[model samples]
Target: MNDVIIRTEGLQKHYVLGAETVRAVRGVDLTIHSGEFVAIMGPSGSGKSTFMNMIGCLDTPTAGKYWLDGQLVSTLSEDELARVRNQAIGFVFQTFNLLPRATALHNVELPLIYAGVGGKERRERATEKLRLVGLADRMDHKPPEMSGGQRQRVAVARALVNEPALLLADEPTGNLDSTTSEEIMVQLRALNEAGQTIVIVTHERDIAEVARRQVHLRDGLIERDFLNSTVETTV
Candidate 1:
């Protein structure tokens, strides 16, 4: 099996703003292997968000090459990128981006539904994901009926329903309390132990401490990339 999940070479992004050009990502060369959990850490305007967008397939790099799950993604057309995003990447946003009115199971099933999965398989996958995330009993509950943590768990379930190659989370704990954030982190760590390749993008140093590896970004370039020797190994 291919071990490299993500690889980038000379990745750069620029925005033209009314005569003044903005350099979002200067030049980043990164490689993330399978079954590895990593944190993309950076502060505001550090190019973390732009880098996340490129890696997530939500935006294309202005100058560079990107490979996702062994495919050349930097040059893929929009339609192709969309396909890659749906099949190879799963995203969990900070706001617990779950459908307010849909049941947890239904919300988790949205991706499969979009992928044209049959109703039976969709339900089965969604149920399994919810169960994996410790929300088996809350499958029928809507986002409004659950606490912030539970809702985020549902979002995690939804992201996993597709069995993505990479689980990408953006400031996942931004909306949760300390206790709840730890709960979610424990759940994520469990998933990582199960061989899932996960990447978390965040500005919070504490939150990044859980990852085994961290890539620090500054001014659109990687400032430091190293194994996190001080990772909190306890739940």
Candidate 2:
């Protein structure tokens, strides 16, 4: 761990559900340094999802401050948040989120397209990331043409195309079989070991075990945050 890539102080998010106000996250203070691999875990209604949204910049918090890669992001405007997300953070979802008609290379180039990178550069970058994820041979294949794990590998390549400061994955292996799930986790572990700062929101204990640290959220607060005892990594 080097620089502080993620920091949240008294982070909170509340939702208005007609007559009821739901406090999805309440006063969570957390910090994840550069090169750290962390997992956020909890059962249903435990606030892990809400907290992940805040971290990913997909949703703004109702209160508190958050800094991503040392930039205060909690108060960023929607457009500004969008820019920051595109440049600084990369996201992976369980659904794969690929365009069924697009080739893996083109799908990986989507973020660069949003960022206005040149087509040539975008292709080059996407190509490099696809190779990084061991999907070089499948770059020309579309989502519908690939297997579940391969499609998710394409998703991973897409997430890495931007060279983001943080890689955030939410239930990344939820749709995969147990074997495929392990494969994704192994990929994530390899990425982290190679020094890509990573964070994942997963409920699977085996998946969570792959991370260097685990934070368990419950009833809108962090119930536990600690380094993996078996890994021997510093806090």
Best by TM-score: 1
lDDT of candidate 1 over 1-235, digit per residue (tens) = 3499999999999999999999999999999999999999988999999999999999999999999999999999999998898899999999988989999999999999889999999999999999888899999999999999999999999889899999999999999999999999998998998999999998888789899999999999999999988768653
Worst 10 residues of 1 by lDDT: 226-235
Report the Cα lDDT for candidate 1: 0.93
Taking all chains together, the TM-score of candidate 2 against the true structure is 0.97
- Residue 219: error of model 1 in Å? 0.3
Q: Can you tell me which runs of candidate 2 are displaced by over 4 Å?
A: 232-235
Best-performing candidate as measured by lDDT: 1
Task: Evaluate model 1: give its TM-score.
Answer: 0.97
lDDT of 2 at 82: 93
Q: What C-alpha RMSD separates each model from the true structure?
A: 1.3, 2.4
lDDT on C-alpha atoms for all candidate structures: 0.93, 0.92
Clash count in backbone of candidate 1: 0
